[model samples]
Target: MLKKVISKTIQLPDNRVITIETGKLATQANGSVLIRMGNTMLLAAVVAKEAPEEGGFSFLPLSVDYQEKFAASGKIPGGFLKREGRLGDHEVLIARLVDRAIRPLFPKRFNSEIQINISLISADETILPDALAALAASSALSVSSIPFNGPISEVRVARVNGTFLINPSPSLLEQADINLIVAASDSSILMVEGAMSEVGEADMIAAIRYAHDAIKLQCQVQKELMEAVGVEKTIGTTHHASAIVCYPIALREAIYADLYAVAKQHIPSKALRKEAFMAVSNRYREQLAKDQNGQEVTTTQQKEWLDELENQAIRALILNENVRLDGRLLDQIRPIESEIDYLPSAHGSALFTRGETQSLTTVTLGSKFDEQIIDRAMEDGYNRFMLHYNFPGFSTGEVKPNRGPSRREIGHGNLAMRALKAVLPPDKENLYTIRVVSDILESNGSSSMATVCAGSLALMDAGILVKAAVSGIAMGMITDPTTGRFAVLSDILGDEDRIGDMDFKVTGTYQGITACQMDMKVAGISYAMLEKALHQAKEGRLHILEKMAETIAAPRLDSKPHAPKIVTIEVEKEMIGAIIGPGGKVIQEIQKETFTNIDIAEQGYKGIVTIFAGNQEMLEKAVSRIKTITARPVMGEIYKGKVKSVLNYGAFVEFMPGKDGFLHVSEVRLERIENLEDVLEVGEELQVKLIGIEPKTGKYRLSRKVLLAPDVVAAGG
Candidate 1:
């Protein structure tokens, strides 16, 4: 009844197996596949519709959405909605990985609207499915009767204690130094995204190669299943170019010559070079309407092909002449100029300008009240460190209305955040909520990497003792599909990145790579070429780090004058009730009297106390009050205790906070007292020593006679 449940399984190098099955569910879609690994299961269903009825878009209309079902994790959804509403940042990010991997494999002219939806139907706590979501989505599209050039799969490569592990469990990831998610076709890597612990270039590259081996085998499994299913993949007829795209023979020839000439020309200013290239494109567009046939109804996409030709022209020059668009050596980085404390009022600020790209970054430190609250699927908590990146249209000389941050902005910001997070001072060492904002004032290429560089400086300027200065570089690669000759370009430009086959962003410090992202458009690149790129990236990264050092060598000795100061103390857990009285009255009163923030938490047998204030006076005031509340009564300690009440035989003395002791009438004086009223009265003061405690009752014994001179007690008797 279920079509026998066709399935194929591949054993991972780590001894874990992934089973992909079809024909049991969602058969109406163009393609559907269920991927299982260690009890984790994800369902990917892809459907395509013919071109939109009245389309405003000419390019491929593709959408990828990923959702995590709480039911799959054996948990009920939280919040008032009692169900998942919008996609969280993590889900959106996962969807982006899949979109980037498969978007390029589709035929350029396949304008049919396509949608891929992936859901985690069964979530295994031990096995993370975010990395596997991409693989499942691609497998679905691969086995379907769709003209996709992929049965690609992605693998998570983690280096734990110097050994590479594929698809490591959550617990094993705790020890990994290098982590990467690599998506690949049979022979070529399609997409790459990962973070590292500043491992060397060689290690990072080796990790990639290791990941591809697993990916290749998975691809083979999908191919076999596709063959066994015997589904005929669709083969769309090759669409011809429109008349407008078919530029005149004379004009096309002239444009090619012009582009080659332009690429060879030595232009230092990015704006001037961009103008030179656009001038040729404008001239060709002007000639398109000169024909009497009236092809003014040309789709925007057709005219865009002319731009593609320009890209090709640039690529040809890069491959043939080993010449970059900027006229720098293949390994040369653009000149970098950086300065700290650029903003007068910012807690910490820096402006980093690398050739054409610029970032004005600022850092702000606050108390726990400023921490960001997370309300997401997997976890809901607070974040003490946050980084935000912004790119305005005017930054790149574009004219468009500003709305909100695009997906690219969010993704880049997240990358930079992780790059610097590894080096931040631990919360216990310095407790302050941190926020870094990078505003792109000018951009040509690698603004995100520029953000990383600027963020490090800003943090140092704010006196944050980061482990080491962090720097980033974006590497570009141009390959000749014919002879397989490839050139890895360092510090690439906008034009080079547009034409290049790969944009590999590598970021870190002198130690190793902190983060990396690689996305390739070609079928595949060889290990030799990839290795060269990594080494070159390292050279560029080190060069940038040296430049950053010239601006700020290390964190300053002090925060700015206006920054808030934090003080912390620990106390016995039993004393917590005294600090936070009934109805939180004591803590509230302390805050009011000192104008400071007090946060308390119980950790096992001890309680953590944190005091945040803007001035020395307030900070000291809060610390003293909390100390008094948590201090314990010590033996033989003299206290000017007040007589709380007088009794027939003794007086009650109020001592250390929340502690009281009995001062016996006989002990009140050296000579025996005839009446208690004659020696002591309520609301009186006396210097007493805590000499002993009743073993059974736990009542402290106070002595005032021990402090009296011996002659005075003898004369009184």
Candidate 2:
């Protein structure tokens, strides 16, 4: 046995070098690669099994898994088990990044089950592993003998101070106005996901082009690595993986006329149009069998050809006829309707329906306890805002068992969150935690965009002072590579999405874009085409926003009367423990007596306190109590207190939260008393004034006569 190691290095714009090597650890896998940048290291391995099992699925079964080891960041796993648990949100999101980049590159009919596993072996917080994971997975596929037309790579471009930096550090990301992730092959851009602080479209395209150059270089490196390793992707040919996939051209031609007519019919119901197309196809198949014309083709081949014809017909109609399946023009958007306060008990709710898609969205405002705490290797914090999306089978007119939210739901929810997050007020202005949930009631296309529309209305209805309203549009593209013509379709339908080359979802306000995602099923689109799509999307978004304004123009002036009010106050940080008291005695008494909720945070020099109550009366009462707890008695100031103890010549009176002042027998009352206990009992209340204080002893001298008449005090009455 012999072990050989070879590595390839690429230089980044910042003069930093990254290296990827094969023949390292996990060499026994089909293909293995370890990528390193600075102290961060990731190992990716891929294995494919041809025709492993027949589960009656036509598409490739690709399983991508990304895992992070706590030890990689020099920390032990959290929780009682002290081991890695289920897949985290970041892991799922990153796995999707890798899957989207490589899934489309597999040979058209290659249906093998491929598993790509990427693990974080070593890492530093500075170098992000998410972008590298995609490169490693693609590099492994490239060097393996698996049949793929890819050597794709993904990069994260972050704009800081108007300059785009590739894969910026954690601290740098904080300063970035735009954080964009791009996955691409040498010649094409495959996937894109990004969030911006209201960045413009031109700037976004420039960042993409910048990322395009870096992706091309990485793809070249992968090709060189594959050449050096002498690995050729002939798995499909060797295993007969796609050997039987042939669409009969004659059958396609026979069905083209009817399919084109059906595509142009503009049927309002998607199901009806789909059924009509199927019926026509069945009739044609019977005619062909009777004539013994296409009987030689297998049923699979016939079905495949029919589907191709449908896709081709739809594309041709859009490109040549300048019409969509729904009969709208290229730049036209579907009809939209929106309503708010649809749910009585919800903090806020809205229903937004566009064409056939509908979303029922609700907003819930919570407290600090509701914020989500994330614990991961490199990223650990609390997220104050969260958005959840759900889609059921019935939404699309199907009868399937409901399991749970799929990865698509999470990804869609994340996009909506990004779109709405930009409009949220600063944390200080809005202290309540916000959660937005969008449930799809009907689905024809772009339910995620519908969610965005509904979420904005829900936020406003909930009395959240968002900076601006946000809307979204899903744009589709029909490209004719040979003819050099393309049509950018706005508000695309599900059918168009299935056959179209691009699914570009843009979300924002009228001024600029907040978040966007574009996944390409075809080769790279030029910047000009992207610009056209963006402008079209903007137009569609504005149209949708105009419709939304009719329902609710802005956030309500006040939250629901039932909603609790939160009043925040700051006290000296050193007084926090005392306010809490020993064993939580003092604060508990105040809460029980005042019937209010209190939350505290220890800031630098002060303790931030928030009081939650049902009404203004309770809120003011709680505030007064807290002020008493933090208030200090000043010399020559009058105070009303309770006598906690009686001494031989003096009494100890409790004034502030825990402060006590000594009242001498001479200052016990306006008249002279023989004994202190005779005039002052242990449980009596009195009004006193601080006369003097011993600085060193920190003791107070109080006189009750100050609050009484001066003549009465002189006469000893």
lDDT of each: 0.84, 0.86
Candidate 2 residue spans exceeding 4 A from truth? 52-56, 237-254, 288-302, 614-617, 710-717
TM-score of model number 1? 0.91
Query: How big is the positional error of residue 558 in model 2, measured in Å on the Cα after superposition?
Result: 3.0
lDDT of 1 by residue, 393-455 (tens): 889999868777777887889889989987888888879899999999999999999999999
Candidate maximizing TM-score: 2
Q: TM-scores of the models, in the given order? A: 0.91, 0.94
> Worst 10-residue stretch by lDDT in candidate 2?
237-246
Clashes of 1: 3
How far is each candidate from the true structure, as Cα RMSD in Å?
Answer: 3.2, 2.6
Quality of model 2 by C-alpha lDDT: 0.86
Please provide, for model 2 over 180-230, each residue's C-alpha lDDT reduced to its tens digit, 9 standing for 90 to 100: 899888777788898998888899989998998998999999888998888
Model 2: colliding residue pairs: none
In candidate 1, which residue pairs get closer than 3 Å at backbone N, Cα or C atoms, i.e. clash?
188-524, 198-512, 198-513
